[model samples]
Every structure is written in structure tokens, then in C-alpha cells.
Target: MSKKLNIGLVGFGCVGSGLYDVLNRSNLIDAKIKRIVVQDPKKERSIDQSYFSFDINDILNDPEINVVVELINDSASAFEIVSQALKKGKDVVTANKKMLAEYQAELIPLAKENKVSLLYEGAVAGSIPIIRNLEEYYNNDSLTSVEGILNGTTNYILTQSNSGIGYEEALKSAQELGFAEADPTLDVDGFDSKYKLVLLLKHAFGITVAPKEILNVGIRGISEKEVAYAGEKGYRIKLLSRAEKIGDQVVSFVAPHCISDQHSAYNVHNEFNAVVVEALFSDKQLFYGKGAGSHPTGSAVLSDVSALKFDYQYEYRKAQSNGGLKYTTDAFIKVYIGSKYVNAIEEVAFYSVEETFQSAAYSFQVGWVKLEVLFDLNLNARKDLSLLVLPDSIQTEKGLSELIEKNLFIYENQN
Candidate 1:
């Protein structure tokens, strides 16, 4: 049995409202929102005025509020609210991925110091129970790779683009449908997925990596040309976030990949998300659910609230047990680079070129390159190139020759 929860909700936006509704309507938990805090008091909302507070201290200073749920848009403000609440010995549930990604190492320790649980299943993959599973089940398994379509907005846009709509039109549709924000830079540029990936790295590999260290490329650069190529090759363009352990080091990145129909991610369209966890004896496992939306994300938040009732806290057992596993980009990746100019491909300086194709519309090459080279290219802000990571099977010379000789590799001229 758990104590009745008095929650101080720190936002009235989509997710906050959704949580409030579910908590009030459902009989799943003994929780109620004692007070709600908002930045702009004048902003029209569905709730009564008396339930809202203009000052965060109203909730932070309240002794009745045993739990703090932070769902604000600004990462800095969310961090402040969560940290203060934790210092006050209040259990916290937050959906601020950027904040957690940036300050998880510090925040996790703070929670332990205060003897309070800091849970953020809502921050990662919306409704997917990934963080909890990684903490509970996969922690004991020898996980080789954890990859998925972690961003709903980018996945939605890519789904629309695959249906023959242009990227701008797809983005506009996503925005209009509220699947994306007015300023969708975070989602479209892959920063959102990268933040989630950072959290996944911590839970999955017991590694703490800076979000910037990963090579994150979103579907923003994916033109119809790539979409056509994917269709021609019986593949779907999905923004994939992946972290794989190679030897003693772990390599992670977020980018657009050509997923075949056989892949679990191929059918994960719109606001859906999927995670593929591959382990030694466990083989492969998939977790799929709504990646974003008011109810979907709110359900995750409510679950954390319910968890807080029984004093559920992430043990971070893997982080404590795994030793000497470092995050690195000093790896070789098989990739397909498509660009309008051939020089852009040459500048990558791939260790080996497996295939090259030239045509009037675009030029591309499939080869192996040091992951650091691509990371540097991104840092240098080269804007004209689109890079796609190829599967590991084609990394060898024999496999590359077989793909080319069998006419399996798709090129513009070949079509």
C-alpha cells in the first residue's frame, strides 16, 4: 500500500492537462492535483482560475504537495523546479528530455542524496515503458544494441514524405495536426531524439555521454530523391536512434536510415515509436507504442506518479556494475552519401569506396569511413550532403562486391 499523492503540476499544456484529466477520471491511483503552476496567467485555459498559480514557489513551498510533476517547455525552468523539489525531498516526475540529458549525472545523484525517486519515463519515448524495462529486465542481459524510431514528429513527417508528399508539406501537415510544434527545429533537426538517446545510453549501456558527441542528423535533409530511392529499394525512410556496443566502447548516433520492410521500424509511422533491443541470449526484442500525444505521454507521466506511490526509484544498477565501458566515435561505419556535388562525397575520405554512381540529378557513393570523419563534417556545417548508414552485413569487401554485382544497390541511373 502507498500513501495518497498530492501532486503539484508545473504546466497546463498538452501533457499536463492530459495527466490532470486522466488522474481525475481514472480509478487507477489515489492522486490529485493540489495546485497547477503556469508562466502566463492570462493565457486562456480549460481549468478554473483558482486552481492555477502564477508563482512556482506556491507549489515548491507547499508541505501538502508530496510530488512535483514538471512538464514545462523550457529546459532551464524545468531543471530549476525539479531540482528545488528534489532538494525539498519531494519525489519528481518530469518530461523534460533536454534537461535530463544535459544534467542527468548531477540530478540522479541529487535524488539519491535526498533519498527521493526521480523518474522520467515520459521524457524518453512517450508511452513506451523503455526506461523502466531497461532498469528492470535488460539490465541483466548482455545488450549489444538498442535502436529505434524515438522521435514522433520526425517519424510522422517521414511517413508523410514516404507517401509522396514533399518534406515541407509533410512538416506543415505535422504542425497543423499538432504532431509538431510551431518551431519544430528540435524534432526536425534530430536534437529531440538525440536527447532521448542520451538517456537510453545511460540506462541501456550504463554510459553517460554528452548529447553533442553523437552524430545526430534528422529527416530535414531527406529530399524526395532519397524517398524515391527507398521506395525503389523496398525500404522506408525512418529517423533511427541507435547505440551499439563494440568491444569495450559504445557508439551512438541519430540519423535517417533506409529500413527494409522486414525491419520492425518500417511500419512504425506517424506518432508511433519502436525500440529494438538486441542481447546475447535474449536475441531481439521490440517495444512499440505511441511516441507522442497528450494522452500517450500523459499516461507515462501518470504511471510514474503511480510508481511514486509505492516508492519506485531507478536503481541504475547497470551504471554501478558496468566498468570501463567508454563512449567513442572512433569507429568505422558503412554509409551511403548522396550529394549534388561529387566533391562533397570525396571530402568524406572514406577508408574504402564500395560503389559510386553519377547521374544528372545527384551523385552518391557507398563506402566505409571513420565515424569521427562524419562527426567532423557535421561540426564543419557542411549543408549539401545527405548521409545514410548502411547495415553491418555490407561492411565487408565480399558483401560489398556481391551487392554491386547482383545489381542490388540502387542508383539513380539504374532506375
Candidate 2:
């Protein structure tokens, strides 16, 4: 008979507790939770108090523990804990995207050096298994683009606000329903999605660029007028994280986009997430599932733990390959710029103005503009301005497709 794997769990919050419950109820894997570390020992929990520990060393220093699972909120603390566990030669699993996005360059190599597994299936889109697919199925395939709705809180709020509910009220409803935190800045401000995009870059294109390098705009500035305008134009407003290979550069960004109902993203609503991977031979493949909630996220984390039983680890072949891919935010694109500050939108030179709408409260214009020029404008920084959506245009779409094909042909010929 196989020996049971001993686990040292960190954090007793939503995902941690859910993982404990799942482990207790399931008999699929021979695993046991030996210890749990949390911030507060006095805090009430449904699990037995005997399992709780105030110090992290109890888990990190314990020689018997074979696996360490970190699911904390603070990225700094998470990084420290994960680093320590890896250094101690314990296989590690975490659901913290921010820490991974920021420190993966250092952490990934460390794990490889130590020959310890560092798996994070719960980091990107919860319960989707997108990471595993990227590492396994698409490893040999030449991918052109990866785009998706990556956040549940903003998606839920956008769905509510588009249905005539006010923005503030929609946010309140999300908070009450436990879909959002009290301070929803990370999720609503696009930082959450940006972090996920950074991780996606590593797996999709074998690139690791900082979050600040990408153009990340959120749904916080989306108003009723913008939502109504999207509806009228046969589009749905969605916060999308997109990375596309053009020439030798990968254009990546996370922002609210106006997608037509005919598009697959329009069908993904509320707290659900969907990822579309476009490859050379595969064309397009969609991955959809519940993106948030304790059970869903916990299920992903448990999958990583189960994989450890068989000594599975991410190969990260693309990252190690000489892909010669570069990251850039210098693409020419089309966008809907809206604000009470009309002068702000008019400051840049547009290729062509598609339409213009004005009201007592705001003014908006749809036009073709260079992404770098728009990024220079910094519309997201202004309280009076908002870059509403990045919509697809016939000219821009055709141009990007051609560029992708040209780049792929060149890559193939060179190899």
C-alpha cells in the first residue's frame, strides 16, 4: 500500500477551510492534514483547534510534512512562506496570483534548482485547469493569442450594472453576496486581472513581463451610459485580459472591452470565467468554468495536491525554450473614450472617428488610435476620464491576423 502524504496547510480563510473540508470528506487520495498555520489562533474555526499553529516553522521546519499549501491574502507573507517551504525541500502549492506574478522569475528557478515541485493550479482562473492545458496540451503548438474574462467580481458587477442597476449599487450587491471584498480596489481596478495576465504570459508565450508594462484598465469607471451604448451596438461590456503575438512582440493588456454577442465572451456572464486560446493549428479553443468561490478555488488547489502524489510538476518548456518573443504595448488599436472632460479625448490624433455621443453628464467618442498614444494619455489616471472599451474593428482585426500569420511563418521557417 502507498504511504499517505502529510500536508502542512497555511491560512484558514475561505479557500484554506474549504480545502480542509474537501480533504476530510474525500477518499480519493491518501493525504492527511498534519498542521495548519494561521494569523490568529484565537479566531473561531469549525475545525479542531489542535491542528492550528501560530508559527510557520511548525510547518516549514517539520521534516515529516511532504507538502505545504499556502493560501494567504498578503502577497509579501505568501512569498516568504512559499520561499521558505521551497528552500526547505517541501513541495509547495499556492493560490496567490499576485505573489507569483511578481516573484515567479525568482521562485520558478529556485524550485527547479532544489528539484522541488511548485504547482499553482488555483492561481489564474479558478477551477478552469487552463494552466495544466497550457503546460501539457499546447506545449508543442504555436499559439498566437490568449484572451479571456479573468475576474469574477468585476464580471458580476458589470453584469448587474448593464442590467440597469447603478454601478455603486451593483458593487454593494457583489459585496453582500461575498463576490467582492470590502475593499474591491484590487479586483475592480484591474490589478487582479493584470496579475493573472502576467502569469498567463509566462505559460502562453514563454515571457515574463512586469504588470506595470501592460496596459491595465478596470471596470470601475464604467457608467450606465457606456453600458447602454454597448447594448445598443450589439455588444456586451466585459473586462478582458488579452495577449497576442504580432511579429516578434507580444501585445498584452487587461481592460474592459465591448464584445459583440456573436463572440464567445458575451455568453460568459456573472462570476464565471472563460479563456480562448488561439493557436496555429487548433484555431481557437475555449475553456469555461466557475472562476471564484471557496469550493471552486479549493477544488483547483486540491487537484495540485493530488498531482503531487504522482510526483507531477510543471515542465514550463516554453519558458525554457529560445522563443525570442518580446513583450510590447505599442500596437495601433480602436477604443471608445468617454469622459466629462471632452478636451482629454480630443487631445490625441485619431485615425478616424466612428461615432460621437454627448449628454448632460458625459461625452464619448469611438475612434481608431494607437495604443501607445492612448497609453501616454493616461486616461485611467484622471478622475474625469475613462477609456471605456477596446473594441474590434475590421481594419485592425485584419491587420492583426495578417501580422500573426507572417510572424508564425517566419518562426517556422527559421526553426
Model 2 scores worst on lDDT over the 10 consecutive residues at 389-398
The parts of candidate 1 lying over 4 Å away from their true place are 379-381, 393-415
User: Could you say which candidate leads in TM-score?
Assistant: 1
Candidate 2 Cα lDDT to native: 0.85
- Candidate 2, residue 307: Cα displacement in angstroms equals 0.7
- Model 2, 1-415: lDDT tens digits are 3445899999989999889887877789889899999998669989789999999999998999989999999999999999999998999999999999989988999898889899998999998999999999998889999999999999999999778888899999999999999999899988999999998898998998987788788877788878887888888888999888887778888888888876778889899999999999989999999987788899999999999988888988887782698887666677888877778667767766767877777888887776777667765566666666555532344575586578679989999
Q: With candidate 1 superimposed using the best TM-score fit, by how many Å does residue 285's alpha carbon deviate from the native?
A: 1.1
lDDT, candidate 1, 351-403, per-residue tens: 77878988867988887777777777872245688877766522233444565
TM-score of each: 0.93, 0.92
Number of the predicted model whose lDDT against the real structure is largest: 1
Give candidate 1's TM-score.
0.93
